[model samples]
Target: MSINFEALDLRAFLAVAEAGSFRAAADALALSQPALSRRIQRLEGLVGGPLLERTTRRVALTALGRELMPLVRRLLDEADSGLFGLRGAAGRGARVTLACVPTAAFYFLPAVIARFTEQLPEVRFRILDLSATEGLDAVSRGEADFGINFLGASDAAVSFDPLLEDPFVLACRRDHPLAAQARVDWADLQPYRLVTVGRESGNRILLETALARENVRMRWFYEVTHLSTSLGLVEAGLGVSVLPRLATPQGEHPIIVTRPITPRVTRTIGIVARRGRPLAPAAQRFRELLIETWADKVLADKVSVDRPRP
Candidate 1:
């Protein structure tokens, strides 16, 4: 006798096996308890074996069900993968979910997206703006296809590809005493109140490490989360800040000015993904676009200087 097991039946079987009761599985699957029971019965009949042992108060999977669990999971995963592959082959386009640090979303992603969309208009993008740490977690959990964050050694389950080296710069009001100087030293900044991104940020860690080496004790007047807010506070003369040069807004923001910090500090921005996983075609294309755009547009115009230089 030929037997056919539908996707819905397999899903119902898995739900029932996991939940241990038709009522619980029904709630989980959003189906009626009777409907779920029927699906499991149909599944067991198709397999020519009893899949579960049921009593008044409980349910438990039989030996055959226990043995089939792994195969069922693999079948589900493979089915989804096969469907995705077919979609790509048919040119239906693929969706990529990208998680990124807020600064990258504010500064780097716009240009890269403009170039990417120009080439692959059919593809869609879902962007998650997260903190550096959170973005890294999202990629590792497979919640996102890939992520862009500060370059640092991540969990062994994750891998990174360096994209750009962005330097930290001092930002102050235009009429501030240090604004007119070519560059300002760490000592000169000590006298002023400092506004900066919060300590949780990777940028903050880099700044703190540099200051620690020099034994500098700078006063922080404000520790804000957003780059734009930090710049706003500086423009209002509340304090000066060290921010990534890339994150500096292009247009004039009242009296705000950005100047290179004399003893240069820099951070590497990179792409991160699951260590052993293959990227979907759309995600791979987007990654390539980001690298190409950074090289052709952003990096080409920069003055080459050794990093962490004084």
Candidate 2:
């Protein structure tokens, strides 16, 4: 169904959501309380549901409103950024939002953000550090301007620009038996306790499928929801973990070391953005900077391998 609503209506909803009171929202929007109510009513009608639940004291977002907040924020932000032919863009917030897998966010974004901030100190960032599936969702739905993700190269809705080929490696404490080896084979891990992420994780699925093809099966002695958790377990000497090399700390960690595993399993880390979508000027600049930052012969050569990522 085609639905049309004015920007003022969205502003009315946002003001109420933020203030949690229609009176305060109306005051902030410079509209009479009744006027604000009508705009909200009109918006609710168009949406076919109430966006808020109003009590005498405060207002709360409905389930649908909770889900709509990110998309709405993005729409208003884009409009403010001169994406919708609206003027008065001087009022734009100058904020850039990107969804990223926690691993990539931890590994890459700090340096990239630091560099971007050096150039554009006035700009701000909102990072949605989600999983691969969630990151892809955010980029595809425009809730994020783009994403740093390991999935979505074949997805038609977004463009995935490869940054590196991150192979799965064995993560263990420096004192662990496997750490003595220059490199470990998948069979080498069979004798040790294995720490892994939960099966629901995208990385787990990818790794499991790839290892199965190599006739290597992993049995998890401990399963956690995050790769970082697995790494923590490994560092504590509970068991070793199999994870992307990028998920490990760069350089040396006093307790932890990663060993290359053969035959290799890899994931392609990259930038993901909605196809044909033009990012706001600041976002476009940051995206370019991120690509340029990773465009290094040394870094690429270090991660590049013959293994095909799932």
Candidate 3:
């Protein structure tokens, strides 16, 4: 046997593996269901064992399938980067769309975008600075190639690669009475009027769920839609806000300061991509850069935070 398999065969396998649904993978690739099945079958036969365990309700990768996934991704990545798989050199200067929550978009993305454009100068970017829920929808619907989000870790349609744990912290003016404490408790915030997002916001939901167990009732003095708005209100001495550490000012602000609030409520921030879809070469490269850059930075920040005081 020549042992030859086309790129499409590998792609078919990759799609179904990511999707966990033959129909979804087929639709993504614009192939008929039976045709997609035949492709998967042909690829499986060439590989010398059953790659996928498929039934009516679910489709999962077998042991061999798990082992082969990285190899398949690498092969496809190489093809997409070059002119062979793409439609000529036009793809060399493509637009990469990314969805991110507002805070991440503002604080994290500028550095990554600067680093990415240094190498791929012609590559453009479309940043969808959406809310957490909207960001997940963008990536799932393929509007964005990827997202930096704190939600979607459990979403069935997307894969989440966690980058960091962003803890909720108390944001208040430096002169506030609670700011004198090294760390504040939920009960301590009871007397002060709280600035918070609406009930429907993901952050609010995560917060309310956690605080419920502690019987910590917050007094909402002002409710804003965006985290930034809450911060702005805090800066103006309106009210204190509890928000993710990432959303807080990093260094000494003239008025605002952040302190860890107990019990800690943290969100796992990560990269989210649609299951079973392939990113374009430019998008793929940018995603890789973003992960590498942020992962190392977060690890360094963690180590510094963990280092004992003198």
lDDT of each: 0.80, 0.86, 0.86
Q: Which residue runs does candidate 3 get wrong by more than 4 Å?
A: 1-91, 299-310
What is residue 197's positional error in candidate 3, in angstroms? 0.8
Q: Which one is best on TM-score? A: 3
lDDT of 3 by residue, 89-180 (tens): 43456898999998888877888889988887888889998989989999998999999888887787887877777889999888999989
lDDT of 3 at 223: 94
Cα-based TM-score, every candidate? 0.65, 0.66, 0.68
Error of 1 at 186 (Å): 0.7
| Angstrom error at residue 203, model 2 | 1.1
lDDT of 3: 0.86
Candidate 3 minimal-lDDT segment of 10 residues: 300-309
- The ten-residue window of minimal lDDT in model 1 covers 300-309
TM-score of 1: 0.65
lDDT by residue (tens digit), candidate 1, 1-87: 566789878888888888888898899988998898899989888888988889979898899998878888889889989997786
Clash pairs detected, candidate 3: none
Cα error of candidate 2 at position 4, Å: 42
